[model samples]
Target: MERLLRIENVTQKFGGLTALNNVNMHVDKGEIVGIIGPNGSGKTTMFNIITGIYRPTEGQVLYQDEPITGMEPYLISRKGLARTFQNIRLFSRMTAFDNVVIGMHARTKTNMCDIVLHLPRKRREEKECEERAMELLKLVDLYDVRYELASSLSYGHQRRLEIARALATGAEILLLDEPAAGMNEQETDELLQIIRRIKELKKTVILIDHDMKFVMNICERLYVLNYGVLIADGTPEEISKNQDVIDAYLGEDDE
Candidate 1:
């Protein structure tokens, strides 16, 4: 398995409080990996560090074996890393299609001068971006609402829209933060299918979700965290049977 991303002894601190403590993990190319723990266990903090929202205080983050630590978020996105937030972050006033179009900006090659002058290259890029955005909306099953304002969609559709936007960024590796947070069982099942399709499309995904069943169903491996420390890293079956993981997150009676 080729390592696509690696967190090498990464640690984050806020004054005296350590949000992450020398955490070590790696995701292989095209793998679906899950990160689960109780709230404040540093799941989102790790995502922030990986996506360049926060630079780790102690270690390095490598993408495709290249050090990407302390890079700007946009730079990371351009390098094919994109993420969704735990809370839905959408352009509520914009059409879902437009929101996705904005995500493609990172990959667009048209210069500002070309865009300002409405040059041929800008026109061509705009056309291509729109087509790509529509395809992404369709992939997330939001094509019917492509022209609708993001805020008008149901919560589940909004969540899918966020995923679609992330896809539009041409990301090879996607970090999803609580993508299933507010979803019901049916919505979550649908989300699982969408994620499966994303994997089929050959993208690597690292998700932090509280839904145990959802994560277990979709992930190839699981990483359990407790109070900023990694407690277990194994297959779902192993994690389910691991006493430490059960005590920290899944209760003893979970099975």
Candidate 2:
């Protein structure tokens, strides 16, 4: 298994509080990893550090064996990493298709002049973007609502739309932040199918969800964080039986 991402002794600080304390993590090609913790346990903070939303105060992050720690968010995105926020952040007035189109804008080769003049190059790029976006939407089972206003969609579809938009960015690794929030059991079940398709698309995912079953079902490995430190890392079965993990977040009766 080739390592797609590696974090070595990462530490991040906000004032006197430590958000990540000498944390180390890694993911391999085509692997689905889960990070679980209580609130303020720094799960999102670790994602921020990996995606360049926050720079690590110590240690290093290597993606594809190259240092990506402290790099700009755009730079990280360009290197085949993208993330969805805890809260949906779509363009409210824009159609779902257009919102996804804008995400592809970062990776499109058409320059300002090409777009302004609507040159042949621009048309070619636009066609490709639309095709890819539609494909991603189909993968997430949201193609029928492509032209619907993002704000008009239900909370579930909106979250699926965000996943489509992130996929549009051509990211090989997706860091999903609480993707199943506010979802019912049925919606979460559908979400699991979408996630399965994402895996078939050959994208590695780091899932952060409140749903314990969702995490354990799809993730090959799990990492438990408590108070900005990693308390456990193991398979779902191992994590379930681990005393430290049970004490930290999953109570003894959780399994």
Candidate 3:
């Protein structure tokens, strides 16, 4: 299996607080991996570091074996790394389709001169982006609501639309933060299907979720974190039985 992303001895600190302490984890191509822990176990902190929002205080992040730590967030996105936030950060006034089209900006090729001159290149690019955006919307099962304002969609639809937008960035490795957080059972089931479809596209996914059933059902591998430390990493079965994970986060309700 080819490793697509690696976090080697990554330690992140905010003044006196250590949000992540010498954590090590990796994701291989075409895998759905779960990062699970209690509320502040550095799950989002890990996503931030990987997406270049915050540079780790120690160690490095490797993508396809190339160091990408401290790279600009836009540059990382251009390199095919994209993510969705725990809090939905959509443009409330914009249509769902437009939101997805905007995500393709980093990957689109059109200069100001071409756009200003109404050049064929610009027209062609715009058409292509629109087509791709529609396809992404369809992927998330939001094609019917493509013209709807993001703010008007249901919470589950909004979350799925965010996934489509992330996919529009041409990302091969997607970091999803708590995608199942605000979802009901039906919506969570829909998300599971969507993520499986993403893997079918050969994309790698790393997700954080408090829903054990969802995580165990969807993820092939699991990494358990607690208080900024990596306590365990293995298959779902292994993690379900990890004593430290149980003591720290899972408790008696892991099943």
Per-prediction tally of clashes: 0, 0, 0
Give the per-residue lDDT digits (tens) of candidate 3, residues 98-208: 999989988987888778886887888888999999899989999999999999999999999999999999999999999998788999999999999999999999999
RMSD of each: 2.2, 2.2, 2.0
The TM-score that candidate 3 achieves is 0.96
Poorest stretch of ten by lDDT in candidate 1 = 246-255
Q: What is the lDDT of residue 228 in candidate 2?
A: 92
Sequence-dependent TM-score of model 1: 0.95
Number of the predicted model whose TM-score against the real structure is largest: 3
If both were scored by lDDT, which would come out higher, candidate 1 or candidate 2? 1
Q: Model 1, 1-255: lDDT tens per residue?
A: 789999999999989989999999999999999999887889999999999999999999999999999899999999999999999999999999999998888888877777788787787888889889888998999999999999999999999999999989999999999999878988998899999999999999999976678889999999988888999999999988999977876452332
Model 2, total clashes: 0
C-alpha TM-scores of all predictions:
0.95, 0.95, 0.96
lDDT of 3 at 6: 93
Best by lDDT: 3
Off by over 4 Å in 1: 116-118, 250-255
Predicted candidate 2: what Cα RMSD to the true structure?
Answer: 2.2
Residue 36, model 3: lDDT of 93
* Residue 150 miss distance in model 2 (angstroms): 0.3
